[model samples]
Target: MGRNTRKRRMPLATKVTAGAAALALGGGGLVWANFYASAHEDGGHNRTKSRGAQVATINCPDVGQKLTKVPRKARRGVAKELALLDRQITDAYTRLAETRQAQAGDANYVDNAILGPLKSKRTATLDRIGININRAGGTAPRDLGRFARCQGVPVDQPGDGDGGGQNQGGGQDDGSGQDNGGGQDNGGQAQNGPVADDFINIEDVQPNSRNLPNGLAANGDGGSTGSFTTECGTNENALRNSDNVIVAPGVSNGAQHQHDYVGNQANTAFASDEDLANGETTCRNQGDRSTYFWPVLRIQDGTQDIDQGRPGGGQDGNVGKIVAPTAAELRFVGNRTSDVVAMPRALRIITGDAKAFTNGLNNANTAWSCTGFEDRQVTDKYPICPEGSSVVRTSAFQSCWDGQNIDSANHRTHVDFVEADGTCSNGFQAIPQLQVRLVYDNIPAPRIENGQVVNPFAVDSFPEQLHKPITDHNDFINFFDEDLMNQMVECINSGQDCQ
Candidate 1:
C-alpha cells in the first residue's frame, strides 16, 4: 500500500488474543494449526507490512485503573515510567505534526520513515507496561487501541507576531522631545506619520537616582571573600538594541513568545528535560549551567491597537511591542555569616508570584521602583514614571535549600526563602542567592479610554478583569556542575567578593 493510504494494524494483540481463545477452546492440535497458519501469513518477517492492515478492536483494561492495584513500594516507579512514556508519545505526535506541516508534499514519506521507529518504541513501551502490571498481580489491560493510533496534532502553534516590534538604534530624537536613542518603537510608532503625541518618550523617562533599599546585597564582613561572581550574556547592551537576550539554541525561533534568558545557552523551545539536565551554559563560569527566563516586557505605543487574543498578553486590551529593561540588576544574597553551598542540579525555582499581580502583594520579597526615580516604590502596580523617569522591575528568589532534594512535589517545598534578616530557616542550608533587576527606559503614557487614563502595560498572564501593569516575576533552574558549585561554596565561606 502507498504511504498516504497506510493504516496501522493491531496484529500482535489480535493474534495473541486469538491464540489464547483457541487454546482454551480446543486441544494442542488446534493450537498448533492456528500458530502455523499465523506464522506463515503474518509473522515477524512481515511485521512492517502487516502493520498497514486493518486495526483490530479489543477491550483493553484501563492502565490507570489497574495501576492502583500495584503495591505501594513499586507504584512510584511504575507511575514514573508511565509518565515518561506519556511525554514521549506526546513529543512524538508533536514532531510528526510539525513534519507534516513543513513537508506537505512529502508528508507520507516523512511519516513512513520517521513514524515507523516511534511506533515500534511505543509498542515496546506497551509491552513493558503489561509486564509491570502482571508482576504487581494486577490484571493487565489487553486493549491499547488508544496507543496504536497516531493523532497528528501540533503541541504548540506559533501565535500571531502581530505586535512584534523591531530593535531600532539608540539616541535618535523622534520629535517627541524624548530621546529615541537606545529604545524601541512598537511597529514604527516613532515615525512622524499619523501617530499621536500621547505616547511617552524614552528621553523623558529618566533614571531613578535614589539609594533604594538593597535587600539582596551581601552583608558578610569583607573578610570572607572566597565566593566569586560573574555575569553571563550581555544584558544592558542587548536591551539597548531590543535584541533577544535568550535564544532557543537548537530550534528556529523556538521561544514562540520572546523572553529574556540567562545561564544555559541550550535553552530553547525544543529543549527536553534531559537536554536541560545536560545542556551547556552561557554563564562566564562554565559550572553554572542553570537557566533563568521570563517573558520580555514590551513598550506600548497608544497609536496601535492591542490584540488581546495573543498568546503571552492576557485577554486585556493592553497592546504594543514589548521591550526589555535598560539595565538588569544581578546579585547573590544569603546568610551573612555562613558560606553557601552550590545549588543542586535541576533545582527549579520561581519568585514573585505572577498571580499576585491581581491579588494584594503578599510576597514580602517582591520589590518595585522607577528608574531615576527610586524614591517612588510601589508593589503589585507598575511604577508610574514621572516625565523624566523610567520603570525598574525587580524580583528575588528563595535562597534557602533543603540541602538534599533538587525538586519537590510542590516545586517549592524543597527550597525556602531566607528569613527576613537573610538567615536560613527550618534547618535549610544557605545558598548563594539570585537577585534580578530589570530597568525599562521607555513607557508609553497611560491611555485615555472614554476620557479616563488607564495603564497600557500588563504582565504576560494576568486576568482579563485585572488590567493593572505587573512589573516582576522570575524563574530559575539550577544545573550547576560539581566543581563550580564547590568553588562557590569556598568563596562564600572564605568571605571574598569573587566578582
Candidate 2:
C-alpha cells in the first residue's frame, strides 16, 4: 500500500464528444457507424456526416463549466439544475439505445423522439438556472438556450470517442470510440462502449512523450520543499458509491458511475459538511479526515458488480466487475516558489475532467501508465500494461488557492494550477499540492480476440463519456482537523517527509 512512484506528469490529451441517439447494426453482427457530430454551434468542431448519418450518444453542452461566477445565493439551485441536465442526457441516451431499429428506418426518429425532447428539457433547465442567478442579484447568463441542442455526431472512424464509440469488438462484442449515433457492443448493447481503439499497448507510447500539464510541478526553490504522507487504508472495507458531494451535493447517482473511496466514511451525495466532519475515517492519523475518491476501475469480462442493476451501474452504461486498488498513496508536496499555506477546512478540489470526452481538453489532467514505465504516460488512451507491470493512475492536484472561498460556483475557480514558472498568479496563494498514486495489480491485461479487445479494463464514467481514458477524474474534500492542517503545512514547509 505504499510506493515511491511520484505523481509527475499529467496525461497526454485528446478530445472526444458525446451524443444521444440509438445506433444499430444489422446482419446478426455489430456494424460500425461512421458519421458523427461531437462539437456544437457553441464551440469545438462541427458535425460530420456519413453514408447513413449515424450518431452514437448525446452532445449537449456542459452547463456547469459555463457558470464560472454564479452568485453564492444561487449556487445550490444552479448545481441542482446542472445535475438535472446530466440526468436528461443520460435518459435520452438510454432511450436512444432502446430504439435503434426505429432510428435505422426513420431518419427523423432521433430528432423527433430524442434530441428534440432533450432540447426542450434542457431549455427549461437553462431558464430555471437563469432565474436562479437573476433572482439572486446576479446577471443571468445570456443565450442559455444555446446549450440546449445536442448532436448525434458519427465521426469518421470505428472505435473513435465520438460519443458513438459504443463499439462491439469484432465479435461486435465492444463499441468503438464515440459513435453517439447508436454504437452497439457485443450482444448489441447500446451505450455500453469503449471500443477497442480506446486502449493502446503501453510500449507503443513514445518515451518521455508525456509532459507536466499547466506547469504543475515546482522549480524547487524558495518554496516549501517537504512532504506529508497519509496512511489511508486502500478502501479495504469496500466503501463505494456513485454520488459526488462536491458537484452534485443533494442529487443521488449524480455521477452515474461507481467510485472507490479511501478516506472519509460518510461521503454520499447527501452528506452535509457536518456529517463529513463527524464521519469516521480510514486514515491512520484520525486528524487527517479528507475524503479521496476516484472512479472505480472495472474489468470488462462479461461480468457485473453488485450495483449492476443499480442507477449508477449497468443502468447508466457501466457494466463490469469492479477492481479495488492495491494501494492508494496520498502525498502532499510544496510549491516551487513559495512557502505553503494551510488549505481551508472543507476545501474541495476535483482534478481532471470526467467529461473530457465531450467537454474538450482545456481542463483535462488524466495520467495513465504502467508500473515500471511511468515515464511514458498517456492522457487520452488506457495503457495496456505488460505482464508483470500493473496499471498506475497518477493525479497531481492544483496547488494554488484563491485565498477566499473553499467552494466555487463551478467548483474549480477556487483553485488554479501554477503558472509556467511554477508560481501562482494574481492573489492566489501556494498550498500543498496533493499527488495521488493508485496502483492496480490484479486487473488482467486485456487480450485481443478476433480483432477485438477482450476483457479490457475501464474506469466508471458518465454513459455518454464512453469510458475514454481522457475522462478519468478524481475528487477530494479536505476534512482535516485544524491541528492536522497546520501540521501538514508545517511538515511541507519544513522540508520533512512526515507521516
Every candidate's CA RMSD: 21.5, 5.8
Provide the TM-score for each candidate, comma-separated. 0.50, 0.87
Candidate 1 regions off by >4 Å? 1-228, 234-258, 268-270, 277-280, 302-310, 313-318, 357-360, 444-451, 465-471
| Candidate 1 overall lDDT versus native | 0.42
Q: Which candidate has the top score in lDDT?
A: 2
TM-score of 2: 0.87
Model 2: residue 413 alpha-carbon error in angstroms? 1.1
- Per-residue CA lDDT of model 1 for 52-97, tens digit only, reads 2111111111133223244433444454444444334434433432
Q: Please provide, for model 2 over 1-499, each residue's C-alpha lDDT reduced to its tens digit, 9 standing for 90 to 100.
A: 0000112223233333332222343321244433233323234323434344555566667778777778988877888889999999989877876777888788888889999999999999999999999999999878888878887755333334434444322223334443333233532233456655567799998887658443435526557889889999889999988888999888888888988998899999999899999999999999988999999998877777888888888888888888999988898899878899999989999888887666655566768889999987777678889999999998888788889889887787778777666778768899998888899999998864444566778888898777777778888899999999899889988888899
- Per-candidate clashes, comma-separated: 31, 52
Q: lDDT of each prediction vs. the true structure?
A: 0.42, 0.74
